[model samples]
Target: AENARLRAREAGSLAELEAMVAAFDGCALKRTAKQLAFADGNPEADIMLVGEAPGAEEDRAGRPFVGRAGQLLDRMLASIGLDRSRVYIANVVPWRPPGNRTPTPQEVAICLPFTLRQIELCAPRFLVTLGAPATQTLLGLKEGIKRTRGRWVEYPGLVRPARALPMLHPAYLLRQPIDKRLAWRDLRLLRRALDEEPPR
Candidate 1:
């Protein structure tokens, strides 16, 4: 954990951070994973969306959100007049845990510094955490996504704070199609916020 903090703190830019995460072997997930599933989308975007971890397709593609869930996410973003070109996307755990298993707490702990640093470097106006793990991890929220989704919270950014919104993960929504209505409401909230933010 100490090593992660030190390495993450040393990253001067997003490129530097990616390089550091690629080289750092602190997390065991790195060993089993094929490659780093870093971030995708415009780094200069006003909105940044973060998910729990990479899935098989994302891991293989070395990019965040590239599978069925990713396709759904893209559609969700489009529903609000946003897309990959307009927003940044990343995952809490860059590597795909073997068989897509949930990352252990220790793994999340070690990798969190890098995730936090990624957000700091991006410095987006809005931080959207998808699913329970990301919302809980980034926002320090204790409640589940069902309870926290759509509510605005403050993200304690290292550079500057951003308005954080928790939302249901696309994968979860895929399993429970009816819950997409909730996601739609959250999307509307985000669109409203974006419309109100005035051009950067």
Candidate 2:
């Protein structure tokens, strides 16, 4: 964990961070994963969305959110007048755990510094944490997504604080289409928040 922190601290820019993550070997997931599933979208975007980890398609593509779930996420963003061009997206764990298994606590601990650093560098105004794992990890909430979703919390960013909104993951919504209504409500909330901002 100390090594991971030191390595993450060395990155002064997103490019450097990506390079560091690519070369980092402290986490065992790096050994089994094919490539680093780094972030995608405009770095200067006002909103940043984070998910749990890379899936098979994301791993194969070396980009976060490229599978069916990703497609759904894209549509979800579009629903609120946003897209990859308007927001930044990444995952808590860059590598795909073997067989898409949940990453162990040790693995999350090892990679968390990098994730935090990534957010620091981006410094978005609004942060959307998708699914329970991301919301719990980033926001330090113990409750499940059902209970925590749609509420706004402050993310203690290293650079500037961002208003974080926890929401159901697109994958979960896929499994439970009826729950999409809840997701729609959250989307409307995000849209309202975005609209509330005064013109820059």
TM-score of each: 0.98, 0.97
User: Residue 198 deviation, candidate 1, in Å?
Assistant: 1.0
State model 1's lDDT: 0.93
Tens-digit per-residue lDDT, 1-200, candidate 1: 89999889899999999999999999999999999999999999999999988989998999999999999999999998888999999999999999999888788889999999999999999999999889888998888889999999999774667999999999999999999999999999999999898856
lDDT of candidate 2? 0.91
Clashing pairs in 2: none
Worst 10 residues of 1 by lDDT: 153-162
Q: Over the stretch 1-200, how does candidate 2's per-residue lDDT look in tens digits?
A: 88888889889999999999998889899888889999999998989999988989999999999999999999999988888999999998999999999888788888999998899898888999999888888999889999999988989874667899999999999999999999999999999988998534
Q: List candidate 2 stretches off by more than 4 Å.
A: none
**C-alpha local distance difference test of each model:** 0.93, 0.91
lDDT of 2 at 135: 89
